[model samples]
Target chain A: MRNELDQQLASAASEAQAAAQTLDGSAVAPSRNEPDTAHPSASVSPQAPAEERPRHRCVELGRAVVITSGKGGVGKTTVTANLGTALADAGKRVVVVDADVGLRNLDVVMGLENRIRKHSLDVIEGHASLDEALVRDRVRKMLALLPAAQNRDKDEIAPEAMRALVAELQERFDFVLIDCPAGIEQGFRNAVAGAQEAIIVTTPEVSAVRDADRVAGLLSGAIAPKLILNRIRPQLVKRGSMLNVDDVLDILRLELIGVVPDDKDVIVATNRGAPVVDIAGSETGAAFRRIAARMLGEALPIPALSDRSPWFARMFASLPFGKRSSTRGS
Target chain B: MMDANVFVVTSGKGGVGKTTTTANIGAALAKLGKQVVLVDADIGLRNLDLVLGLEKRIVYDVVDVIEGRCQPRQALIKDKRIAGLYLLPAAQTKEKESVSESQMEHMTHALAGQFDAVLIDCPAGIEHGFRNAIAGASQAVVVTMPEVAAIRDADRILGMLGSRRARVLINRIRPEMVKSGDMLSVDDVREILGREILGIVPDDEEIIDATNRGQPVVLDGARRLGAVYSTIGRRLLGEDIPYVELPNDGLWLQLRKMMAGLR
Candidate 1:
């Protein structure tokens, strides 16, 4: 069974490599799982032995954090694109991985859709080197993307393959943010396998929260999953119709890392092939930047979002329920 | 003459009414005097059993049948309220990997041979569960809401359907929102998807109540949504039917659709 899957992935990878060569005319190594010595940067080749590479450049292993929401269309891909951009803007080497095979959206959301010549399947199946598969951001020098295959399903890559791939990526980038596909199935399992920490994204809807609660319960391992409440309409919360941050926290019982309000600019920015984080004066963009800073160990205050509420309500929200040790591990 | 007896109801995004569509369509087909069996292929996150009010009666699920713990007939749960309707529930505790594509194929083939229609409720995302669900089916019912993200996911799903007969079912459309241009209209969805729309269900609150009561909206007497699902079933059975008019389909929108059709 394993050999059949490996063979299928190998053939798919070669097809991708051929497509990439046709598109870019870059001289790619025709051999499987071998170092691309034809490239100018052979020293930095991902297939190079550890002793030949410069070890002093990476001070510490990068953090592999999986951004997942159990429910679909709840802004998991959007959060991943914006957060990775924010981290790259803060001078951190970040690689956002689209782990949603067959439904890959991270590439399009980050406007790197056309640049994907090779994908995660190619690297995992050893048809392309890790360096060959990584797509650099158009403007950001530090941010990169490891896009998923649009043709293959999630079961094509195993959890062990994903864990090893993330470990290899950790040696190069400062952060590896995996954009997990929705659902609590093999796709979810594969995305969470490589991460030491997780960021659970959810909206205030009952279905999204229910799925989030189920996912939080699933991630009961060493990783204490943090929450990023996205698309909160404060007006609905004030009207007692929608669940507020406190209500979601009460149900999820997770540490709150970021609270982003609903902004139409996010939609406009996404459809334009640019993340909201890169847009000027976007409140959602500012929220992502703050979350990135907080991820980097900054003790930024979590915004309560309900600014129109009375001062006493905001005070009570901040006392115990708002933020929970967000600055612990950097 | 087993011509496309199995249909997999799927949407790339979750909570977009895949299970609800499967249950209602199965019930509607059964009500049409056809032997219909609804298979919940979601595995670990099974909801079709609950939607059909057959949760307590599930002794053997799809996983049990595929894994050879029980025969396919032994695992089938017959609905007491509706004659000729049955359910093959998914295992609540087993992950999707417990059932492989070939196993699902054999199970679905066996079930399809005995029933007039086999409606599979596919799990969200195009992964192991999706592959397993679509393996035994000859047709797919792609469900989606009128939202941008849902439409995008549905478009992706359409791309992945690959030679399997597929149709789009737009669910949970609010006519007022479509009139006010707050939501995508049926014409907008039809244009974006560029596929044959099987049916369009209005945004109804009573469907939720009916679902909470462990009954499909098709079984509820007072809701027009049930008739829409029945119309969808008739269309699936190769009937020429006009799309149901929504509660308030504005004349201007109809004129716009007419103009678009001309173009």
Candidate 2:
């Protein structure tokens, strides 16, 4: 019975994608100066090439970072979606790649599920060119998505194929954020193959932290991975129930990139397939923006979302030797 | 003689008690006079050895057998308490890419020839490790919590299993929460997943205590926790046993029904 269902699903997924305007640039050719006919209504001025645009900070041409977590359901996709939006909102060209084949969630999270005409597997299998497979975001032209096929296995894309794909993406975007699948397997290796940096996301739990530690060890020799502690409830930490940021950092010993508080607004945003970072007044949105600033080399101070420290702690901070948590910058 | 049964226990989301279910079910089947071998297919993050309390006894692991460093039987660690139970531990220092699906299939086939039942503990995620774990098994025992995220992943895995005679085992169900409508009911989970029920195991602190001591609850001789898993084992053996009644089902359920009637 399931075989019939599986085959039906596979056949539906294998249907040919609708034709999209071929991108103006390719991996080998530097033709980004040409305006993209794809997004005729994009807000950004098509005449200004992203590479030649002036910025407050002279950001690197292309930065590829894979956001990964060893444990499943710990908000890797959420972080990738929001952080990419935040970066693109900051005037950086960002392309978020959903590298989790067969379980693609970034498209749904980013509210671009219907806009996905082609995916990374199509590029790898030679069914679509790199330019033809790209899906540009409607609201933010600077933000684009490279979705993963829903019916294929992770092993279908080899590490070399992934490296080439990421390299091609790196040429066009200022920030290439790859949404890595959970577990340190073929999917992980493929996601990390072309990336120069990694962001390990984990929740404030023993099991999630332990898995993060294992992933940290694996990534030690290649890249010094940064940490993003997600779903932290300050009330639980203040009540001595959940693990504090310091406790998690003390265990994993990785540099903290971002600490996102548990916010109900995130659920609402996700349900609508919109990124929380794009929603106004969302604490998780603010957190992702801060993380994006830090990624852009801004030494922004990470404020404690809801810190109600004791009197002595405040007094200690006033004493020159002790520093307040809010004063600490990454 | 009937064919040797090979069951791969999997959950798409981590920390959903796939390892615990694998340990308990393998021990329960072993206690039923069947020669059972539990294979830990999670290569890098191996925990079945620690869960079975056989970490010290594992001189050779599954990777070692696949890489030709040791014979298949040489890597099988015998259980101290159960006579017919064995374990093939995963290598702690290796990665998941170390073994291919064909290698895993060959190893499990060899073990099936010698054992009456072979149960594999699969890693989380539908990646290479998940593919390798299911490659060797004829049947799948998918473990999941009654949460939305876990159920969604389990549904994806069930879809991928593609008619391999799969069954769902809902673990860590809190009956009080279910009664209070704070959690999904067993019927809700069954309807959402649309799979055959192996059994439902309640949230019990005793299971945690047993796990910490490297003791499976099924071997404890206790009635509540042990019986829950052993009944699933009996069901696996093709016996028609009724599902275990949760602790609060007697009076609490009757009270709830009476309250609904009053309303």
Candidate 3:
């Protein structure tokens, strides 16, 4: 048993080295116009024309980004689907991996549920190749999904195995977004294993905020996590009845990437098995676009939702009669 | 003396008011003249003692009793305000793995012989701490709110507590939102969870104040949610009382009722 395990490790190491060498070989040939400088394989020149530079270096290879929330029903899957679609819509080759093994929902949300024949477990067990397991989106050419095995327990895929699977995907895709299962247990650990970054989805509720804080703490050391405050109610925030984006950011103390409003279109889009980003005129969809833009290092202004109350309502509340009427609003 | 009725208050998701429900229900039961003891099973994050206003008087906790550092009776702290209420606090420094299932069962059984009701406040998540919380309890109260995520977690918890006489307690419900079809209705929660309704707690700001002031809302007896908790306590003791109708049933509620009648 020990010898078999040792052989597997040795083969995996060599396979990684070979894959790295192949990537270097292709990247080095494009830079032949330049001098054979020190560390030719290490640094890909930035001056190499836009189309000629390695696509892997555009974002960084094997950059696994895990989207997780410690509490259930906080729209982690929704955020994953929308972000993946938005990123793909931006013309980046993206594959969203469902790491919630037994309770998979990312496929359904992405409208790729009908396309899945094999799954991540099949890829890990060597029963199927990564391309065979990956289900491409019907509408989006660049977006794909690696669905989780519906019947398999989360323990079937260890963190190390998940890391290897993600590494393989990273070689092919520009962005790998992992939809993590809700909890701080084996499933959470497995989802975060291969990811270089994390995006935590939370609502304005105290419970959701508290759970997000816990998840942020857990992912602090290994992964650079950013926050996405989902389902924000601007009216409630204006009335001081609910936690706003700033309040949530203060408590979680993570960099804010997105603030999606409580838009009804999100539910409609999900029921249709399409990402909210595909639905036109959705505020939530616009929010997701801003998030994707921010992920690409665009300095878009964070939309101010706190002052969304109507001018009439604001003016009335300041008046004595308006004060009496506004009390009923809360 | 009657054998104590042990109840475990649990919700698979965190921050769904499990500890708050445990503290209030235990206090309400004791207010009705039943000897009650609240057990905090969330070892590391102990909040039941603070909720019950008994944090400063704690000398030993459930861990000490299970590890034989103190007697079970020695660890039970008497409530300062309530006459028949007591608390078996969880250890703040100990991890959840420190207490085993069998040890929790043994301790709860010993306390069952002394108190009229034992309410164990289970931690969040369906993990080891959850197993320890429900070890010796004969029934479970699964608490949740009207959100989709909370209901899903409650459904998962109900599946885990199979054949354990579990009932649903819907917490922080907004009747106005329900009437306007903005939030989930009681029937919606019932259909999703598929469990018998234990009670419905309205979203009240006073509950937060009560917790911060180290007092149970049921002690006030005048607050809206306070009355609901007391009614639930009596219902648990075999009283058949209908749930209180929330106030402000305006035209929206009438329209909703008419729509329901048409359906």
The DockQ figures for the candidates are 0.20, 0.20, 0.08
Estimate, for each residue in B1-263, the C-alpha lDDT of model 2 and write its tens digit.
11248889998877678888999999998998889999998888777876676766879999999999999889999998988999999987788888999889988988889998999999988877988999878888999886665676788999888657889988877666666665666778888988888887776656644653467888888646777788788787678876654446564454334223322
lDDT of each: 0.76, 0.74, 0.73
Model 1 per-residue lDDT tens digits across residues A166-265:
9888766668999999888778889999999999999876546656777887897758999999988777666544656766775578899999988867
Question: lDDT tens digits, residues A147-228, model 3?
Answer: 9986667778899999999987776565789998766667788999999999999886554565576677778888769999
lDDT of 1 by residue, B1-263 (tens): 12389899999977788988999999999989999999998877676876786776879988878778888889999999989999999886788887888888888888888999999999889878888999888899999987666787899988877888999998877656566666777888899999888887766656654654467888877766787799899998778877544334464355335324523
lDDT for B246 in candidate 3 is: 43
For candidate 1, the per-residue lDDT at A42 reads 27
Better model by lDDT: candidate 1 vs candidate 3: 1
- Indicate the docking level reached by candidate 1: incorrect
The CA lDDT at A323 in model 3 is 17
Clashing pairs in 1: none
**Consecutive 10-residue window with the lowest summed lDDT within model 1 chain A:** A321-330
Note the clash tally of each candidate: 0, 0, 1
Higher-TM-score candidate of 1 and 3: 1
Give the lowest summed-lDDT range of ten residues in model 2 chain A: A16-25
**CA shift at A107, candidate 1, in angstroms?**
0.8
